[model samples]
Target: MNLGVLKDRIFGTAPTVALIVCAVMATDYLVNIVLLNTPNAYTPVSTLLIALVVAAPLSYWLTSQRQRLERLRDDLSASLDAKQEAIEEADRRRGEAEEAERLYRLLSDNLTDHVALWSPKGERVYSSPSIQRITGYTLDEFMALPPQAMVSEADFARVQKLIRGLTPGGPPATADYECTRKDGTLIWLESAYSLLGDGSGILLVTSRDITERKQLELDIAKALELAETASAAKSDFLANMTHELRTPLTAIIGFAEVLRRSRGLSQTAARQVGHILDASNTLLSVVNDVLDFSRLEAGGLELDPAPFDPAAMASSCAALVEERAVAKGLVIKVKASKGLRPMNLDGPRLSQVLLNFLSNAVKFTAHGSITVALSQKVEGDAALLRGAVTDTGIGIAPEHLDNIFDRFSQADAAVSRRFGGTGLGLAISRRIVERMEGQIGVDSVEGRGSTFWFEVRGPLAELAAPEEEAAPLLDGEGGVRLLLVEDNAVNRELIKTMLEPFGVDVETANDGVAGVEAMRQGHFDLVLMDVQMPVMDGLTATREIRAMEGARGAATPIVAMTANVLPEQIANCLAAGMDDHLGKPINPTKLLETVARWSGRTHTA
Candidate 1:
């Protein structure tokens, strides 16, 4: 296909042809000059024949040999070109390989995780420079050291076992180990193990330091344990303090009630008695508020929901504060919506919230009326009950409204001193409403009025038939024998005074031990056991009495009359063979009702 080759082939025979012609001319001239010594005596045909015979063979031989040489030259030139290309290709491949090695070294030297390559025969063939940083050993030194010298005997054995079990194409395995650095500091290491491919049983291991993370985990665990211990201690302290506080309150309120009900007192004395009762009740309220707030703070406040009329509950709450409001010469109006069917809700807690609102209204208002409005509407399957206490009171400033429901916070120190309160009622109310999945807020204007409101949702429920109020002991019945187990002398006396008016025969025990003995010696209609006493507590005493009774004797109704009023404490009382729980400051009315209900009779003179 090359034109130069074609041109060479066409002109290649020209030299041979010219040489043949020259030879023919020379031979013709020699024959003419030698044979007849005349240039005219030569014969053209014969001479030409002779020259052609010799020159044709020579030309054919020379041309064939020259063509063969040309073919060899072309082949040699092609081979040189191919050889040059091979050399360039080899250089290119070598440069690429050098660059790849440089990149590999860059990554291996800079990485934080230590990398090591091990051959099939348990030899560390290569180690990254980071091995010095991770384990305090140079790469060469790390590779030189025996495996057993680098790790503990147990770890060496475990790693060897793992390596023996590895497959070339299987997933990598990971583990954590406690290791010691060259400086002898203990540290935790999380390591990943993998086997290389290509039928060579090589292993690759990568490891990083997790010492800080491990220490953090340990610190968190210790902190949690300490917090739990502190919480438990606080709960125990609050329980004891509550008992101490309520025991005295029971005596104070009980005697005050007895005195207030007595006949033939002078007007001044009656008024003083009333003041004492009011102060005692106020103190009791503060104590209760503190305890309630504490329970809420500790996430221990639980709602006990039951079916109760929302309207009736609102009216009852209003009535509770009615006396205080009327004494302040403030009119109270309850605009509870009619036909608000009973709903399943925590009636007592809800009432507590409403009472807080009304009490605040009465305390803050001077001459204006307090109105309690209750309304209900159906939303989906739930009935939303909204209760609001609106009053024309000395309204709170905008700044104070934001934090009015904060615990122990009031609208400035002046307001706290002007209106004596623990500042816990609104906070406790807020927590209660929130626990029931409700929202609470206030709308107020300075020196005009304030409205505190809450909205909660519950399902409509069938009204439980009204419970017959537990009647007091009636006259003309058999003597109802009872035992009062209390450690405090005043509380025992107060309880006896509360029950004896109903014609009941009351016996006394100083402690649970004495109470148990009394139960063993005689039969009683009921036992009022007080918790937290010397020798034994009421729970243990009740258990002892039950054990003495066994299966054949009738079960005496044992009611827990203690200052331990927490829900769990009540549950404990029930679990310990007590039939009921009566929390103190003892309500004289409820005390008589419990006795009458349990004893079922009163003594006749």
Candidate 2:
């Protein structure tokens, strides 16, 4: 708009424009003079001058405009290309971000576990859709809860402490808690918490339902408790049953032996008495077998070993079974090694095993002889003793051989019924043998016979002298004062009868209460106390008596004479201040032997 700036721009192109006009005019003059021959001043020059002034300036202006337009077009194309490139780069980044989001959703949505993100302020921010499956709560519902809603008030503080203690890339802490579901049902959840705040300011939590596992653990604990209680009950039942059975068995066996030994019956009456004694002895053996098996099963059975002659024990067992063998029209031969020395072994248990074999032999053998053999071999400072009972009988079937020693098992159920056995003898014997560090086994053919054998290691005793013969009740023992305390009337009368024959001045008391009163009133040299009585037990009365008369009680012997005859039962008697134990079904000889050993001094008779 300024005239001077306009003149500067217009005048800047004036000279170039004038020079083009002059050149064109001169060329036109020449062309008119030389070629066209129109050299007249007004003809060619006039036209040239006109063309120069108008067309030449116009061409220059148009040319300048065309160059400007071309440059503008090039710049416009470059700007469009740069814009397209930027838009394409933005689209690529957005696609990648969407793909990442899809992958995250795929992993989190399909899992059974609840995956969640919580703000550092303890607010639930993002929850995986699987939260619905695990907790019955949708993502929206979870997020809408209070910041600490994931944990109960009881657990909120603990969760907060756990969250605060988390460090980036450190081990995650795990804990289990009771959680409430959307339906208000209680469930257990095990959760792992991690600090995902390695730039992203949130805590990561992964959780799973664990209610069933907790239930399983609780169930297992109850099952174990029940099993232990059942085992204890079985042991108690076996112990009580043993005591009951032995009490009656003592009276039957003891009185039957008394009648048999007294020899006061007519010949026919004596035969019947013999039958009674035989039946009673068989019943006693059966009872003893059952008791042994029960104690072995309950782990209450133990061995008591002492110095004894092996040959003598086996011979004694053989002698007992010989009568049965003879009654059945069978011969029983006893073969014993003369070289047998005294050995520290459980003589009673050893005798039990041999008697079981002999009894079976006598029972099963119809016509052929039964052989009882005892032998010994020397080991290093020890003796390996072997005993065998062989019989020619309806032999066991090969299939039944292995199971014969199993409790309640026999060759057949028919065999058990016909033989009238509880099928416990061999089993009890096997356990007894194994406890002594011995082996018991059988070998047989179906029709010929069976042989049962056992071998045990024994410590040789220093002396091989035979058991001292039971001397007759000496003159000094004739007036030995004895107190018999028993609850059962039959037991008391039997004890009195057996002791009175031996010249013992025996007085009886019905129970421990009476016995204690009698002890206080009298000065008996020995008290034969019965255990398990009413009003007061023998153990309690013993303690009371010991306290009542200190030095005199110590000097006076108290012996336990009860049906409870296990070694532990005897040990209990001793522990209760009793001087000795005598298991009942009292044989007259043993009662007298115990009497002589305790009160009656052995004089040179």
Candidate 3:
């Protein structure tokens, strides 16, 4: 307790105590003086003693009262100190809570995500400034208008139903809806809403934009639909193509068989048979082109590159169409530039491109001459060999030229009906050339003629001379047997017949499992595997065969034969341990050549 408070308590107790003590002391002094004067009348010592007794009791009472006042002052001071500490603590806590609330308000206002507080009665209590970013409306405008104003017309009804279903006493419910921006663009938003506990009646809502996510979903749906449509169209085309292929193939195979079996047939009859075979081969080529075009559209085409003479390649392609040109009484010419550089090209694919151009020119030209030109042009430091097939034929319209490279599109419907083509040749050729990193284009005038051209770049180095010749037939002298695995009976028979002529002792397996069994049961030199089959695929069979080969301490080459010979598919086949690949329908010459190569025999034409 303070000294001043203690003094006030002591003084405030009473003036009566102070007066009593003073009277006692003064009486004692007076009594002492009287006793001295009346020394003879009585005992002066007794009077002095009585005065001392009175003063002692009064002094004790005054001292006790002052001590009691000091104790009361201490108690009052303690109570005041406790009250002041409590008030100071409460003020400090209030400041801290206010600071926290200020930070929360600032964050809520500045956050990118939309934040809003709505009353239980569905009134807009508060909205963040970010509402403008999401809905393109000012904060004040959003607060003034109904929340439904921002919802797209298509989604407003559903949003309303969802909002009405929310319960104040229940847990939060989530909803997604489309909202319209101020510029009339629609955006998707996902919102989470929950009720606040205060009786002041408020709910908290937070929303985020999902526009890009929604667009991606839509794009995925569209792509899926397109895939399904393409798949269905491909199935239909395959069915039609199978029928188209079998018709000509049957005639060719049957007539060829007849010519082989008959020794008495005349030269004229033999020549007719040869013509039929050529025509059948041409028709089969058309069917294959259609299938290839389909595969290319489905991203399923592959290329094989090897060294070849550009001049020789051009002459070979020209030879295939020369007869038709001659039949039409049209002069055909081939021109190769001097010192033409050899190139590393996909030989068969280049031939296919040349053949397509040559055939188109021959078919379209009635009397005018056709020319197949092979030349080398210097492009910077690189040497490029250019191949061009030009003819006086019915040319393309300017408007239809751009679309001619599209699958199943021709110059016109009339041209398709008159020419009887699948309209896939140019498309396939274009894709093949592009795959080779080459370019193809056409120059034409409607009534004049057309010139189709392509160019390839490679080293100008000279080719080494071929070594000594071997037998025409593939080597079976090693007693090596080949297992031909194919599902289609026609394809199997066709491959079997072609290989037999090359003296390759051939065995057949109808499916992948059979092929695997054949490899296990016999000492096979090679396995020709087809990809699409029942039970197990050729890729799986090839892997199994390779594993078995490792176990037996022997190695047998495996070759893949696939209708869908895509680059990815070929890579997959190679990855599965297949030695090489050949697309179907098999070319007899190529089949024999590959067989010779793997059978440890040099091939000679």
Candidate 4:
């Protein structure tokens, strides 16, 4: 391809051809001269004839040699041109490869992930500049030592073993190990490696520092364990306290019921009995809230969505708190939007939220009015039904506003002491509201009133025909049979007393063994089975009952009554054939509702 080579090829061929022509000419000349000398003919004609012969052949040969040399030079030129093109192509490819390497190096230096190549002898041959960023080590520092020196001493042998087992054509290998930094701090890394065979004494390695990712995983694991531990402790406490508290609660409610049913009771005594019942009910609410909040915080609460009359639900919630408001001489009002439709909502959870707001309002307000308003608001393409609970209660300070919905957070510590609460009501309410894809917030001014509101979307049917109200079913007469399987005697009595007013005929079992026995002998409409009972738990009993043959096989619905109210716990119960789940310190309304729904009867108080 060089011009010098082309010139050399051309000139070398010319000289060879010229030399051959000269040799042929000289030979002809010598032969003529020798012949003339031998014949004694030194005449000018002979000399002229010989000179002519030599000149014709020599000129012809020289001309022919020159043409051949030119042909050879042309062929050589074509070959040189091809070689030049090939050389240029090779140069272009080399430049491209160099550029690619430059870009690769740039990326490797800037990337956060660590990159390095290890030799088959377990030495680091090349490590990117990112080593400084990831491990506080310069490239020189890393290159000065074996790759294993950066690995934790505990993992060095394992890493060596892994390297030794690698084969050139084998599948890629991966490992997670801790590497020591320059400061002696260890960082977790996830490494993926493949062998690159170049007949060179080196292997390619790539690793990523996964310290944050690994820490997150560990945190999650620890959180789950902590949750489980707290759940167990709360469950045990609830079990023991439910038993202890229910004993007194049973006596109080039972005595009041007996007094109400008795003849010739004094007016003062009757009023006192009513007060006792009301106080007991309030205490029961507090207990239920504590248990419910614990379960909700522990991620045990769940929503059961169903179609219900939106107006009716709102009216009922307002009515439940209306008597309490009236007793305090406070004005209470409810406004239902026209043409309100049926909605799919978790009635119990929604009611809980409403009741908590009402209770808080009643506790804080000494005068003025409380209003619960329901109306439809149009946002974008969707219709949202907004429900607001506005109250003339002591307003929250601006500084405390943001934390009002946090668990155990109150406007002031005095609020907890004055208004007895677990400080979990708003937190639970917020969780329920958010879970339903709704929003909850408060509007308040200090020394004025506070308005707590929440909004949830309702079905279009209810939105269109708002006047319709679902009539409350008449209470069923005759005693309803209930089988209560609980280990604690006090809990058993409390449940029995609460149900007795609805004419519930109760049967009890101390544990799963007795519960199974009771089930075989009696035909009860419902079974409240407590989990974590001695001699077998509720889940096992439910399974056994489900496995029964004939009419007794999984017929009667079993509702789980346990302190373990986590989502997974509920799923486990259901999987074991439990029809429903209820947390401890169970709400009487919830129990009645579950009974009414499952027993195909209405409950009245």
lDDT of each: 0.87, 0.81, 0.76, 0.76
Q: What would the per-residue lDDT of candidate 4 be over residues 109-135, giving only the tens digit for each residue?
A: 798877778766666777889888888
Q: Which candidate achieves the best TM-score against the true structure? A: 1
Model 4, CA-based lDDT: 0.76
Give candidate 4 regions above 4 Å deviation: 1-173, 176-193, 197-265, 295-308, 343-347, 379-381, 397-402, 436-438, 456-508, 521-532, 550-572, 580-605
Order the candidate numbers by lDDT, best to worst.
1, 2, 4, 3
- CA shift of 532, model 2, Å: 2.5
Candidate that beats the other on lDDT, 2 or 3, i.e. the better one: 2
| TM-score preference between candidates 2 and 3, better one | 2
lDDT digits (tens) for residues 1-605 of candidate 1 = 48976566557766786678777877777878876588677776777677777766677667767888888999999999889999999999899999999999899999999887888888887788997888887777777777777567888788778777878978888877778777888788888888987788888888998889989988999999999999989989999899999999999999999999989788899889989999999999999999999999999988899989888898899888999999999999999777787889999999999999998899899997999999999866679999999999999999999999999987889988998999999999999999999999999998999999999999889886777856545443637888999999998888878777767788999999999999889988889999999989899999988888875456888889999998889999999988889999999878877887878532221
Cα displacement (Å) at residue 521, model 2:
3.1
Clash number for model 3? 0
- Candidate 2 C-alpha lDDT tens digits along 1-605: 48964565466566666777777777777787877887564365577668667865675676557656877999999989988988898898889889998998898889888888888676777788887887787778877877556568878788768878889767899988888888988888888998864777678899888889977877998888887788768756655776787788678777877887776778887788788877877776777787778779877766787888887787799888877888899988889887887888899989989999998988877888999898999887799999999999988998999899999888997888888787899999999999998999999988899999999998888655666754445353478888899999988888877777667898999888999999899888678999999999999999988888775424477889987876577788988888888876676677878887776432211
Off by over 4 Å in 2: 1-214, 217-221, 299-309, 326-332, 336-348, 375-385, 434-439, 456-476, 547-556, 565-575, 600-605
- For residues 1-605, could you state the per-residue lDDT of candidate 3 as single tens digits? 69986566555544545565556556555665565554344544564466456645665566667677787899889888988998998898999899988998888777878988887788988888888988888888878887678776667777656767766656777788888888898999988877665656677888889899988998999999998998978766675555445533643554465464467888888777777766677677676776677677777666666778888888888887887789899888899888876766677888988888998898888888999998888665457878899899998899988887777888899988987777788889899888878888999998788999997775555567997654344654534467899887777766766666456788999999999998888866667888878899999998887787775565787888666444556788899988889765455567777776676431121
